[model samples]
Target: MRKKTPLNKQIYLSDHYTGNIAKTFQREKDINILQWDFSVEASLVVKLQIESLLNYIVKNVKSKDERRCKYLLPLQYLFRYVKKNNITDILKMEIRQEKEYELFVPKEVKKNSGSLRKFIEFCRRILFISNKEIDWSANVWYVEGLHINPKRVSQGTPILSFSFLDITNSDNRKALQEYVNYLICVTSMKMNTIRIRQTYARDFFRYLEQCNLCIFDVDYQITVKYMKKLGTQNLKSQSYNIKLNAILEVIQYLQTRNYIARFEIPVLYHKEKEIHTVNDIYNIDEKLDILQKYLYLFPETLRIMCLVLINTGVEKGKMFLFRDTDFYWEEGTSWLRIPGENRSIPIPSILYWIIIQYMKRNKLTFDAQLFHNERGKKYSTASFADAVSKQCSKLGILDGEYIFKGSMYQRELCRVLYRSGTSLQAIREYMGYSTEEVVKDIVGWKDEKVAIKTQEFFEDEKHNLGGKLLMAKHDKMKEINQLESLHKVDFALQEIKNYKDSGRIISVTELSRKTGLSKGFFYKNDRVREALDEVKNEQKEEQLGIIRKEIIDYSLEKQLEVYKRELEKTKQENQLLKRENEKLKKALDKQTLQYLKLLAET
Candidate 1:
């Protein structure tokens, strides 16, 4: 400035040297030379000038230390300037790379490798720097100064994985297994049903593991995938949907534990169209026949149990509750009284006779159970199912894998009944269904035949005859409508005339007000005209009544005259009969005297 130095060179030297001098001088300086104040417009001009000066210093300063000094100079100058101007100041500065700034950690950090890798990747992406250029030793300084808690962030993925493993290993999983076993043993549920529950649980755990989340992370996508997988098995919609409910139960369990945050499982898609056909029943019957043969030859009570199931369609648990006393023969009806619900079903006469015959042939007492094993004890449900399966295999009826227990057998029976032309209402009653719709679902029957028959009934020749009779009646009624109206009008008119004769002019308004007739009556004057006609009708009816009375009286006189004539004729006949009787009696008496004389002579 003393020699009129170039503005760029002078500003650059001032910026670069001041930072160095400040660092070297420390707190020994009593006077401050860096402070400067400028006017508002001048201040803006100076800021731009300082920015230019810093850029020049940055370009010109070659050494690493010099460049760092150049970077710090603008901040120091701005601080001094703010103090001189009494301006509120905020620091806006970019850090220069220093040798000490680096992330230092072993390349093979065993404990938190995944987290460390992720952190490195995060720095590369967020700071837009190459991995090689990033220092690995820096602990306090971050390039972007972003304070990411490594311990917190790094714990998520591993902890989530461990949580999933823990659940799979826990007693809850054991409980689920126990539940499956119970379903198989006690509930008469199929292996397929158990398999469905297992698969759902496995998939749920897998989903949690893969997503690095708990069961709470399950979403629509995960559920959809599970459904799609089930769909691939080509299961019937109803069967598939029933299995889906088991899966939902597992999800509900997780939700109850607070492990699952959301719940929106899809409901079974019920198809209104009937999918079962006549062939399905035939197949079921064939299976039943095989099972029957096996039970017969094996001499096991389970066979009789299976036969009972096929015959009665009772659930497994309910069947197990049967006792010797549950069966009774009364009034030609052989019935089984179920426990709990206290419902009873009359066995088919044929089945009833068969059971009676079997009991008699086996020398079993009337009070003895119809189904008992060699052990003389009721078979458990599982043992019963196994016996049925063994018998079915022996009979060579292997069309499809059959579950010995569960609603499948009952549903199959329903299908058979439906195919056999059983009415839905009758089926519902027989099956103890709460609603007809449930029977329809179990049977998978369509009401198309009923619908068509209904439509035909309404459109048949009989309906046409009824329609014609109704139409004829309607026409006759229409013919009497005018007469009926005239009669009503005449009555009203007579009343109006009486009113007029009494010096009370019944205006339309007054008539309406008194009779509560509508305004339309005034518009057409129909009421007034009808009233006039009513008077004529009344006079005519009076005259007709007098004539009718006279005719009746004449008829009654004629009837009396005819009665008198008949009475005289009757009296003449009676006199003739009396004369004949006297003549006959005289002849009888003479004959009797002669007979008496002859008797005396004998």
Candidate 2:
């Protein structure tokens, strides 16, 4: 009789000597956590094929969890189907999306909505090809996958996706489509930036639709309308400026393309309501004491989530998209390597240890996600942010005026960097700010590093013109002309803003009369016009709210009556709950006697 092969060894190292995940890796990753027992009976040749496939998958795949999750179950199903059918060759087993979709996406499964679609994407990523090399994408994915587009899965407040189809004008629709496809997708802009642009672009387009105007003929009037709408919003001044600037960039892009008439707009005209001080950092000793232990003792998902945010200044949305593979370790250093970013963020040594410990506790192989729930799916950014916020609130470290939902990490990290005397460029790089000024502003760094040293230093034309022999004189002229034009416009805009900041009313009549400027000039100058209109509209809304106060009072009276009724109903329900609790307590005592009697009899 032929000697029987060991079943467990047969599963991984049959005739397929491609390699094991541990031995195959040249760089010694601490992957002992990935080893698992395996035992399956199969034909020698079939086992060989299985081993070969597994090696190929394990070698190329980033996460052990993903490799096993996507392949192992399917492979088992294939083995069962083949053995039951008594097929000579196991290669003929093929998965059809239709039946698989039915099995995976059915409501009978535990709340796994659209998981079949996710599976389809997972399949696409791995490329479901047979050993014979079948081109399945041509038949399966391209045909069925055309309709498998993901819904706008917003991770957090900032990553908003807009449906451009909402725009009614054909020209506007075409332009916006091109903007999304060509400008956003094809260009080198970051994903967060792209999303921000999409949000405000949609807002601008929707505003245009409401006014029954076309973007191709976008003029100064509708921009004023847009500014006026923005002015009445409940956004904080910084957030207000961020949104306004994002929208303004797109408007500038449109004007640059000559699709719309050019206009200048300032980010914000609002004065600083409160001065920022070092006191904003708040109770450093208490926060560190809480977080140091909390970071180690908390659940793997929460600890690693907080650890990453604190160490690396990645946005929360990017954290949601993290796979365990993204946590790349080399030698002793660990890096959070997100796609599309040029730099690999080095994790702090202490946090790296914590991260590894957390991963090991959770039994995370290279296949599992870094920040997923027990179900192996990520929570939304908002959900994660709420968790962070709640924890911070309990610690009394939560900022009263948070700029972003999940800003605790960024704020703390910036504090550490600023205190460490890290350079503005380095801070900008870490925080992913494009400009030095932005980095300074966000971190509240009170330094003139990004500011112009002296305006008079480059007063001479020759000194201003660098030794770039290729730069034509006319180019310099163009630059100077643009600056002069922008300066003139900015001065007027700032004047309007200053007037408003001083609590001076700036209506068309008031502004024109005060400055002795013509109404036509005030209305014609786009920057002056928009700022003036925003101030007027805000004042008008204030007056309107005052005039409408009686209606508000009547509504409040009705609300008060409703509140009283609700309070009475809630009190009655609580009383009913008390009686029900007493009944339940008596029943529990009766059940205890019955259990005691039964146990005594036994």
Candidate 3:
């Protein structure tokens, strides 16, 4: 039976940006009398003509023999139309249907077009008619349906053949189908990925057919030739690279199985992904702008998702992978685990309340998967991304430079902290990435301690940065030629010294702006850093020498004064002793005069 809304079709339409049609398909349940399977046996000619389509659909949909099989619903109506209109009679069909079809019995029809456009596409696949042979004006739905040119997704069945893949080689087609099925079931790949791979495979296979070659004939040279043409597309490096890799994977798979020769795949360098700088981390204003919707107006589901993404930095897949038990909320404290991130992290009270309310509404228990898609199946990437995307657009915050994924949340959140003087280590721990490098790549803060140390000099309003800081260090000016390896010990040291001498450093970030180098660059450049250290030591020694000289001058002056006082006192004492000696001699002389003999005897 036809579903209320087809999940795979929703993903298909969303990925193609097939916006309103999906709603049209689901909401406009205009007719209910149509059967969902063919009752009459197909004529021999019709059966022979649709042999491949039938075979493909049979393999693709296992419930082919069952009544009301969802995939067969559209086809059952198609067969009824074919027989009712006696369409086999063949008209010039030179005139387009004003509307695609007008059902006879109920005399009702879809306002736009019947499912004729889809039927025609199915016919083309069955018959292998080239695009050029098809008449565009014959179908009323031509513009609305075909103009968008949604890719014909491969269904892991050998129903349709690309020109590049040999039409006569039934084995190749079967193998490709088997491969696609394996990818879907065993690889646990996402549906969107399956569609994309299908699209890429079609393009590559068609190109191979044009070149008069097959997978067996493929080599590095052929792939290189293909890439040279691929390089012409106006996609961004990242997008272009992803497309290239998709094709490479197909070829690589073939090579791994010894069906083709092995070769190294080319790699593209998208400079923007290198790492987010401190700048990519947003300031308070930006953070407030992004987070305010979650705080107040967004739906509960979206709010909780945004909160978790903002807090834990987990991607959509892993964010949805969590069970209720992963969240530990009780009493006054709360935390949750994002598997593979290694530890639990504290959550805000508001988030806890939101999750509890959501769980209660959904009747979720501790063991239930906390999130799911609309069909009550496991959470799907396309649905979650679409939900987030719509909200971001409504807020008028979507930007071409950044995608609003979980990683972007991390970058912006970390940026806010970085701007506010939060340490890198703290931000990294909070972000929950396994490696510091991953945090650094996402938000480039190389050293938590040194990253923002220079901020104080710029913080003080009274100091003239050019005059009081760099100029004094350079003896008067900010000329690069004049200062040779003199100022950098650590990027932080200059900031530290600036803070000490001038009592202000606005931010390491501001100093980084002044120097026109990333904060991480100064922190990470080892070769230049060693020289910077030597220069710092030299400056320290010179300052120490001047202090030492002043102390020696003061000490020597005091010692000289003490020596002079001691000499003077000694002289006075010697004079007194001399006087006493003279007195004694005079007395001796008088005594000698009185008693020359006594004196001589003495």
Question: All models: lDDT?
Answer: 0.51, 0.57, 0.52
- Give every collision pair in model 2: 63-366, 63-367, 64-366, 64-367, 65-367, 66-367
lDDT tens digits, residue span 247-355, model 3: 8778777777777877775455321143323333345334434465344666666677767776655556567667765666444346777654567777654455556
Off by over 4 Å in 2: 1-162, 185-187, 234-281, 293-297, 307-361, 391-602
Q: Which 10-residue window of candidate 1 scores lowest in summed lDDT?
A: 155-164
Question: Model 2 lDDT vs. the true structure?
Answer: 0.57
Candidate 1 off by > 4 Å: 1-303, 348-382, 397-426, 437-602
**Which candidate tops lDDT?**
2
Q: What is the full ranking by lDDT, best candidate first?
A: 2, 3, 1
Expressed as tens digits, the lDDT of each residue in 516-591 for candidate 2 is 6655566556776677778767865665554344334433454576688789999999999999999999999999
- Which 10 successive residues of model 2 have the least lDDT summed? 139-148
> Tens digits of per-residue lDDT for model 1 on 153-238?
22101111101122333334343444443443455433334455656666555545555654545666776677667777787766
Answer with 1 or 3, whichever has the higher lDDT: 3
lDDT of 2 at 222: 72
Worst-scoring 10-residue span by lDDT in model 3: 89-98
Instruction: Write down the TM-score of every candidate.
Output: 0.33, 0.38, 0.42
